[model samples]
Structure formats: C-alpha cells, structure tokens
Target: MPPRTEAHAEQQPAAVAVGKATPAAEVEPPGKVQVTVGGAEEAGSEGEDDDDDFDWGAAKHIFVLSNAGKPVFSLSGDEQRLSTLMSLIQGMLSLCADCDNGDEMESISAGSRRFVFLKRGNLVLVGVSSSLVETASGDEGGEGGEGTGKEEDEAAAAAAAPECESFMRLQLEYLYASILFLLTSKVQGIFLKSPGYDLRGLLGGADTSLRGIIELAEPSRGRGRMLAGGVETVWMDPAIRSRVARNLQAAQTASAPSGALYAVWLCGEKLVALAQPRAPSHHLSSRDLLLLVNYVATQPALRNAESWTPVCFPRFQKTGYLYAYIGFLEDPPSSTLPRPPPQGNADQNSPPAQHSDATAGTGSIADENEGRRGGSASADGGTQSNGSGSRSIERDSGTEAGGAAGDSCVILVSVESSSEQFQAFRRTRSALESRFRSALGTHWDRYLGSGAELEREGILTKFCTQMKALHFHYCLRGKQGGAPCVTQCLSSPFVDHELASNPAAQHRVWGYYTRAALRVRRGSCQEGRVFCRRRFEGNNGYFGGGGGDGRGSGSPAEEGNGASEEELATALFESDPVHSLAYEVGDEHTVVSLFGKRDGGAGGGGRWVSSSSAGTGRLGGGDELHVCFPSSVSPEDAYKAAVRLTAIVRRDRDWLFLTGTGAAK
Candidate 1:
C-alpha cells in the first residue's frame, strides 16, 4: 500500500511511530533457533516436557519458520532446539521433494508421525501430527469390544485419515488468514524485504488473540472463521436494523468525497449495519467485510484510536491496498446537548477535492486532529475530553456530544486511497454518530432490550410505518404457537379527507382487508415467518370499501372493546407466498414485514395504523388511514419513514417496557 499523502498527514489525530526493525542475522546461527527474544522466553511458548498440553489427544504442535530455516513460532518447546527441528524438517523435505521451481513441499509421513506444510507468499506453516487417526471403530476395538473385520478397520482408517488431513489444512488456512488480518498483505512484504525483521514485534499483544482463535478452531468446538467465510451478523429488531442500515447509507453519500467506498458499524465482531453506494458496479462481499472486521477487532492500533492503515482485501483487488480509517464513537449523554457552531480554522487548509456539501460549513479533518492534540497536551482539557474520558478533538472544538460519555461504538470508513476524500470521512463519521444517537437515543445500546418485551408489546407497528409508502400492510404475531397477534395497518395521512374523516364507516372495508392478511398468516405463519399476496391485474375491484370475498362485515366497536374476530380475520393477502422479506425489528418479539404492492391508482394508494392503540386495545381500530400516497414518494421516502419511526418506537418501548408490569391496559 502507498504511504499517506501530505494532506492525510496533516489530518491525522496522532501518529503511531514505526521504528526500523533490527537485522535478524546478528542474533542467530543458520539451522539453530532460540525461542527467547530479548533474553526472555516468549510468554506463550510451551516447554519441552509439556506433554499434558496434548489434551487435544492428538499432536497439536505447529511451527513457523523463515525461508532461512529460522524458527518463528512453535506449538511447544524451547526456541533454540525448535530452530534445529525446523532446519531438519526443511532439509528432509528438500531432499525428498523437487521444490526448486517454487512448488511447495506439502505433506510427508515417517512411520507414525506426519508433517504437513502450507506456504504463503513468504511464510511457511508446518503441522506435526500422528499419521494414524483413531476412529470410533478403532476406539471400540481398543476398548475390548468384538474386534471388527480387517477390511472394515482399514476402510475406517482410510476415511478418518483424510478427514484429519482436511481438518489440519483448514487450521492452517485460518492461521494464515489471521496473520494477514493483523499485519496486512502490505506490511508482510515489508517484513520479508528487511530479512532481519522479527515478526513477534509486529505481533505485539496479539498472541492471546491468535491462541484463542486456535482453541476455537478445535473440532470439539464450533466451526472456525474460515469455515463460515462471512460476518456473524447480530440479530436485531427489523425496525432498528433498517434504521441503522439506512443511516449508514446516508452517511456514505455524505462522506463520498472522503473516498469512502463503504462504511460498516460493528458491535464488537458482529456486524450491525453495512452501507455502500448503489451506483458502483463493485461492492465488498460479506466474506471480505468479515475479514476487515476481524482485523479491526484484533489490531490494537486500529481499535485504540482514529487511525488509518493500508489494507489489501484480497477478494476486492489483489494488486494493491485500500486505506481504512477506524475510530470508536462513544454514546451521547441522556439529554441532547445543543451542538456548537462549526469551527472555521479546523479545516480551512483541506484539499479542494476533499470538500463536500455535507461538510460545507463544518470543521475539517485537520481541525479534528488539532482539537484532539490540544486536548491531550493540556492537563485539564475540559470539554476536549473524549466521551469515554480520553482527550478528544471534538470536545476541544465544542463539537463534543451532550451528557457523560457512554458505551463506545466502532465506525470504519474505507477509501481507495488517502488522496480520495479525507475530509468527507471525518464529516460522515461525525454525522453518523450524531444521527445514530438522535435516532436510538438512550436505548441506543446494541445489547439492550429482551426478546419477550418486544413480543408482548407488538412494537413492530412503531417502526413498520414505511411499509405504508410501499402500500404494504403487515401483521406481526406473538411467539406462541396459537396466540393473538398485534397487527398494524398503515397508509399515508395524506388521504382523501372523506376516508380519513369517517374510519368507522370504512370498518367493514378494513375488516375484509384484515381477513386477507390473517388468512395468509394462518395458513403459512406456522411453516414460515413471512407471506405476501400480490394482485397484478389492474384494481380487481378490491379498493372501493367493500369486502373482496363478500361474506363477513365488521364495524368499529361501540367504544372500549378489542378487535372483532371478523375484523381480525381480514389479513392483507391470502395466497401462496409470493414475495416476503422478514426482518427482526426488536430484540426479541417483533419482526418487520416487507410486503410488495402493485396498484394502478391515481395517488399510489396506501394505509397506516395510528398510534391510538398502544397495541393492546380491544377491537383495536385505532384510526386507520387508507390513502393514496403522493406519486413522487420513492424508496428514499420509505427509508426516511423507517428512520423516523425507529426513533419514535424505540423511545416509546423504552418507557413501555419499564412501566408495564400489570395486565395489558
């Protein structure tokens, strides 16, 4: 990866120094490896007699060696001795195999021991294990069970050995991917060119992380990250999920000039939201995004501050690296603080190409760095303290958020190069934090809220208002196999005044519609979570306040009663599942439903459930507005509705969950 441009240097909040690595030649002899670095045994090394460490019940040792046959890592034992072993292994492989043309020497067996080799561009991984795999049948025979026939035993052995080898190969791939994630493909080359470079220094405090990954890779445990090859996404209420995703999408647009190719928010290692532009013919794959997340979580420099690093996402482009800017945004206070005016001098010197409309009147990235630097230099930095109590530039510039610092969240922005739009990234990060805090408010903690609370409350109505713009009516049911569901109907408030004025008279019409939605759910909600009914033929006479089926009729209850069974039965559509997109909209109970519509009407008709019923009303006909949405409404409008509804519903639920211990009101 190329070095940061001068503009980038000016905008960096703090620079981490990279010292020249000392030559490796002075410390060791060829074919002789010492495990100690700086005259002390490395912390994670296993001693020679560490036989008890074989609780894996197999040879769990692995070693890394330089091309010169110097030891870099070992599963156990002293370094000096391990270097000799590495050299011996290399010699044996070279003598027996023809690798001069660069084809790697893979696996070899000597009696009961087998050695496996996996080579990257300049590094090599070697695994030492027993050649024979003990299968279930083998164990049975050894345990004094009736001995199996010789043919069966041999077949089992053959099957088990290959599986073991495959498993070993997977471990090696994980090991290599993790290292690449840490040092990056760019820095790996730097290590090789220096020859004397000690990879341990580059590893820093990452040994524990790597060890944990290895332990997690054991077959007794879950699948390794390589096996999944994608991000482990967190499950969130669909309403919240849509809000978070849409916010990121908007931020990406605002930060475009900063060279942002994509933006993602991760709650630790689990992906919460990912945003990228729609125009680009290319986008990051889930697998590549997961790798990026792994690197951010494992690398101290990236996690600790607003740092930029050059990274090569092998899946995106193999020839070069991209610049990634990573930082953690601490949650805002309980009360929203009035934002300070945008500072002028902070970014007056930014490059012309990096300027953006989203940041037209705001401080530049340089200003952010200045604030951070000044705050840190002073003993009592006052407002400059980062929300987490660390000194921050935003505080210094009066752009710090309100309230005491809260939980910190990560924000990652990647641009193709430093020269792209450095200023835009800073602006986008600031805007995203502000928007997220505003939308989620005090309940913004990703881990907050339980599944049961969301279910009983029927909160999907609070955030599923966007479906109205799409002319979608949805029912979000409870978890019980056969229990009542809180169904929400929505249409734009901008409707025919006649329909809006007299909801009761339209009750029979709405009831018939409700039956359609219910029948769809009744038939299939048990088998699958979502169902959608579509009518492509123009109108089909279902819109004139009449029952489509011409049987049941429902009227608004006389005052205080729940929905009539007849009204409850009229679901949106009743057909074989056509198109369905379901999203978990709450921590537990609610899933936002996405239903499609095809209406050839004057105003693009829609409907919405009003907030009159807190989702528990008997005959819960809380003012349903069925209207024709303005034709100009687009997907962006739906996104905006989702954002607004998420904020309102989340705040409402926070209070509802806290107060409701009694029977439904």
Candidate 2:
C-alpha cells in the first residue's frame, strides 16, 4: 500500500539479515538448551541475548500468554526463552492497571513500532508490528498552527496512529479466536483452576492452525479477507449449486442431530454450499467460515480422516464449544491415480460393499488404525468394535470402483455432541454422501475435477474479456433474517497466476484498494478522490502514484482533491476520464475505481487497464456490482460491463449466496 515508513526502512534489515558469528573467546558455552517451538530458531539462552539476536521490532510478532506471565505461544521466537519478555509485558499491564485505577493499557507506540494488547479471560494477547500509519501529508491539509514541519508531521502521525492500532487489534482478536476454536471458552476453567498451567502442552499440535491464521491475517498474504471479514466463495452454475444445497439440506434433515446448527460443504479453499437452521440468527458468519476454512486447509491431519473436534464460532456463540464432525467426501486428485468412476445405481436393499483398494489408495490412517483395532461393519451400516466396545462408522468412501479423485469435498457439521446421537449421526453422514453423489452424478466429476479451470475459462473469462480488467474481488453483504451474510468471488488468475511473479506490485495494488475502502467507509471521500502518480506517462499510475515527482501538471495534493461525484460521473460518462476515481453512493455503497498500466510491457510501454472497483450494493440493484476494468476501457464502458456482470450475479444470487433455510437457490 503506502510506502514503508522510515521505521520500517530502518528495522527491515534486522528481520531478514543473518546474525554474525561470535568469536570463540567472546561466546560462552551453551547453557541449558531450550527447544524451539514450531521449528523456529532458538531465541537464545538468556533474555538479554535473545533480545540482541532476535529482531522483535522488525516483523510482526504475536504472543499469547497467561496473566501470570506464563508464555503460551510466541509467533516469532521461542516462547520458553521469551519468558522474560512475557513477564515484562505482564508487568507493563500491571503497572498500567495500578496507575490508571484498573484501566488496562490498550496500545503503546514506540517510534515506528506499535504494540497492541488484548485480554481474554485469564490470557493476554499481544501484537507487535512495525507497520505505521500513512502520512497523507501530500493530500490531507495541515492544520493551521505556528509549529515546525516536523511537529506538524508528528501530530499527523499521532492522529493516524489509531488506524494502524485498530488493525493490530483485529489481528490479536483473530488469534484469540483461533485459540478458542481449538480449546473453547472452557479453557478459562483450566486457567482458573491452575493459573500457571502450561497451555502450550494442551495446544501441542496446533502450531499449523495458529500460524495459518497469522498468515491469513497478514495484509500482504490474506488480500483483504481479514479486512473485509468475509470468506471467498467458489462460483458455480446456479442449477448445480441449487442441487448441492438441496442435498446438504436433505442430509441435515435426515441425519443431523437436534442440536445441529449448520452443515457446510467446502471444496478446497472456497465454500461450495451451506445448510443452516431455519432461524437466520443461527446462521454461521463469514468470519467464522473464513477461520474454519483456513484451519482446515492448514491441518493435513484432518484430510486423512474424519475428526470430531470442539470448535468455537465466536460470532455465533463465544461462550461454549460446538462439536464439528468434519469428514472429507473425496480425496483430492493425484497424478498417479485414475479418476474414480461416477456414482452407480446400486440397489439400496443390497449389502454394503467394501472397497479396500479405495481406502488403501487414499491413505487414511484412521481406516488402518480401525482395522487394527478390530473395527468391523455391522449389518445396519455402523462400525462395531470388538476390543474397546466403542461404536463408530467407517466414513463412506463415496466410490464404487476406487478412491474419488478431484477437488476434496469436505463436509463439516456443527452440533452439540451427545453419546446417544453419535452413531445415528455417523449413519446419516454415510447416507448423505450417497444422496449427494447420486444427485451430482457425472457433473460431480466435471465440476469438482476442473471447476476452477472451468471458472477461468467460463464466466470469468467472458467478464474479463469485456471489462478488460486484470483482477477483481467482490463481496456482497446483506441481512438474511436480521443476521448479516456475505457472498464473495475473486477472479481465478488473481489468486493464482496474474502478477504472481511481482508480489510488490500486487501488494501495492491491493493496498491502494484497501486504503480507499477505509477512506470511503470513514466518509472522507465525499467529493470523490483520485490516487495516482504521474511517472513515465501512465506507468502503473495507481501503484506508482502519490510519491512526489516533478513531472506532472499539478502537485500530488491538487490531483488527490478530485472532482465531485456528479462532476466526475459527468466526465466519465462523457469524454474526460481520470486515472483514479473514488466516490460513495449514499451510505450503502462505496466505489473506488482505478485505471493504470503496468510499469513494464512488451514495447517499452504498457496498456492502461482498469484495475480495481470496490463497493457495497443492495441485492438485485445494478449499483451493487464491484468490478475492475482495463485502463483502456472508459468509465462508461466499465459501467456497462459492470451492469452485465450484475445481471449475471443477480440471476444466480440465490445459489451464489447462502441465504434462507433449505436450498436457498
């Protein structure tokens, strides 16, 4: 987004630079060795040594520790060695509380680094980041005062500090939520019983989950999912989506427990379908869905077998645990295996057939373990244990011939765990798989097999062709039965290939949109705003803009103070066009449109393309569309393309979004 501040420039080296070797005379013999957590480098034998070696001030660092000063998890360094730092953090909070009549410290700013603190139950979460506030000195007017330029700049920085701190706060909140997802709020009881309890011992295998959340929360990697608080969805045909939903609904009705809340179907990273309770208030939130998906994607163990885990959806109910029965319906395709045969019309009355080859090929540890445990299938479609006297059903292979290959289909059901309903639930899960596979038939292979590729070649291709846009991300927000729901879509190439080689450029582009979105939400762009840099005549104007260069007609400030919405619309609709335009349409929508050419191209010059369009719109309204267009495309042309895209979305809105009760489509 904005250029790195002076602080980032100064501290960046510490984050990436390797440490110099100490001489034998200077270096002391190794003391009691501390094991590194999550494969991170040891933070050193002593706190002072750790501080000297670790660049805590450089990259973002997250710490979850007990109020008793016990380190739980450290994102960057060894928590055991960082125990001293954890104690210092606790001391600061205690000092703040004692001094401010129990008012805790929320955030602390030290030069370019900012530390934000959050307390949940007996635990304290801390986030330290070098990310600083955008100065905006070139655009925002300086308040009238008899102060030096440095003083004014400092004041501006102080005023903008809250924005960066808020982001850090959000990161900490997500981190805490992830902990709750794993341990539930009941973790508070453990802390209450034993304040010095080592939470790390309990969270032993959750390193990947915690790290995945952190990575996704990072601005550069997540690409606005955390900022927008929404999940990316897989775009599919309305009819097929409807069928998928119907099957999920049937499964939920036939098999789900009375305590069932929601049943979600996911293919890879994108949500495919969801079946929630009739009460819209009971629906799962986009934020929870995003977290759940990320957690699943990160945990390879989950892919190998069915799991019964206690997951907390903070938005739904933060106080307790919801039992999630997560199972993969199909194994992700591999190059070595032949594609599984389509669903067969086997007689329902026939005995269940065993597919040992499919189970072996899929490499399910649970199946092998169960086989060793003397687990056997009963006549009633449930597994009976001969040794432990426990009951569990073997997850349906969902194939008559061999292991299914393509996108892995994950079915996650959230319900209250009960011993009596457990067996029935397992049986229901098997039946649901049968019903779902039967409904999709050959289309299952076609869609899950090559759905992503098809999307790139299908509607997305058509839209990009007409709009001349390089990438697009759209999140539609609305209320269903008074609960907020969101549907989102991202261009295929945007996530995978386009600009893949140039991460800095991609970050810059996304950063522009994110900042513009924040500004629009804050009502700062009432008269519209333009963010562009005039460098080398239309060379990546949006990304390359704002930095002062003595080449353009007007100062950066003058260019930023763009025309009013009405005037800008007139200019775009008519003849005159601008490089960047940001305006809000009433309270419900905000649009930020940018046009620019990449810096490097085939002939020493690049074609300007419409880059980004972000806004909220009412369902079925043309104004609800968010799109990106090529720089060559005029505003009018972009508008027309948006209209076309809107129509397509409108026609498929039911399937596109997880709306009301059964089969929203």
Q: Which candidate should be chosen as best, given TM-score against the real structure?
A: 2
Candidate 2, residue 55: the lDDT equals 62
User: Residue 156 CA error for candidate 2 (Å)?
Assistant: 14
lDDT of each: 0.38, 0.49
lDDT of 1: 0.38
lDDT of 1 by residue, 510-610 (tens): 22233223332233222111111222112332212223332111111111111111111111221112222222211111223233221222112222222
lDDT of 2: 0.49
Please give each candidate's TM-score: 0.45, 0.62
Worst 10 residues of 2 by lDDT: 567-576
Cα lDDT tens digits for candidate 2, 26-117? 22322322221112323334457557545643447888899899999888778887887787778766655554233445554443345667
